[model samples]
Target: MNRLYHVALSPFCRKVRLTLAEKKIEVELVEERYWDPSPDFLRRNPAGKVPVLRMDSRLMAESQAICEYLDETLPNPALIPADPEARYEVRRLCFWFDDKFNAEVTRPIMNERVWKKIRKEGYPDSRAVKSGLAAVKFHLDYMGWLLDQRRWLAGDVMTLADFAAAAHLSCLDYISDVDWNRSANVRDWYAKIKSRPAFRSLLADQLPGLPPSPQYALLDF
Candidate 1:
């Protein structure tokens, strides 16, 4: 059986999970404590990251690489466009969410609110939380602008870009950090994605000692 080493709330892990689910790949989920990296875990991924995937006589590290491999191997309901230009746009958006959005928002908030509690590594940083909260509004407005012009972030089709963006936002939503009402367009886009069969396992995730927000699992939310 395929298996994924992951932390329930990590956006990077969620991206891979979403991709796998979209392609209808069954995988055993194993929560890992990457901070206190074990030898076995390190052997799986020397980078000491969550979301090390073991499948088909192969071990994969890096979320994008794993997702792309899955996309190539399992082509049903393709997440990447065939057109070169369209594919470029999709990849660009994926990087924007995974790198820029993550650095500007996800990491700050998760490090403050969730990671601190899990690692027992001191208290939440109010300053970081405040900055993250402020930054998210800008992202939401930008998303709204994009959705107003396109059916999806990258194009008309729901691609890996949407999954990447939604993965980060969903983690924040679990912590009640996202303000859904900030943009109706963004909210509607998310609602559509959130209602997909691929999203069920994500909604079902329950991190020990960290209660999900009231609306985290609510489809109507």
Candidate 2:
């Protein structure tokens, strides 16, 4: 059986999970405490990331690479575009969310509010959380602006770009950090994505001692 070692709220793990679900791949989920990596886990992925996918005698590291490989092997529901230009746009947006937005918002917020508590490292830093919150508004506005111009983040079709963006936003949404009211377009986009059949598992995820927000599982939300 295929298996995924992941943290419930990590956007990188969620991105791979979404891609796997969308491709109708059955995977046993294992919650990995990445900070306290075991020797076996290290053998699976020397980089020690949460989203280590073990499938068909192959162990895959890197979320983007795993998602792309899945998309390539299961072409029925293509997540990456076939056209080079379109593919470039998808890759660009994927990086925008995973790199820039993660650096500016998701990583900082999750580090302060979630990881610190989980690791028992220290108290949540108010300044870091505040900065993340402030930065997220700009990212949301950018998403809203893109949605105003196109049906999806990369283009008219739903692609990995959408999944990448959704993965990050869903984590924030789980913590009730996203200001959905700030952008109607962005809110609507999220609502549509959140209602997908593939997203059900994500919505159902229950972290120990950290329940999702009320709106996290609400389709109308």
Candidate 2 residue 121 C-alpha distance from true site, Å: 1.6
- Clashing residue pairs in candidate 1 (N, C-alpha, C atoms within 3 angstroms): none
Candidate 2: regions farther than 4 A off: none
lDDT of 1 at 170: 97
Clashes of 2: 0
Residues 124-220 of candidate 1 have per-residue lDDT tens digits of 9899999999999999999999999999999899999999999999999999999999999999999999999999999998888998999999988
Q: Cα lDDT of model 2 overall?
A: 0.93
TM-score of each: 0.98, 0.98
Q: Which window of ten consecutive residues has the lowest lDDT sum in model 2? A: 67-76
Q: Which 10 residues in a row give candidate 1 its minimum summed lDDT?
A: 50-59
Report model 1's TM-score to 2 decimal places: 0.98
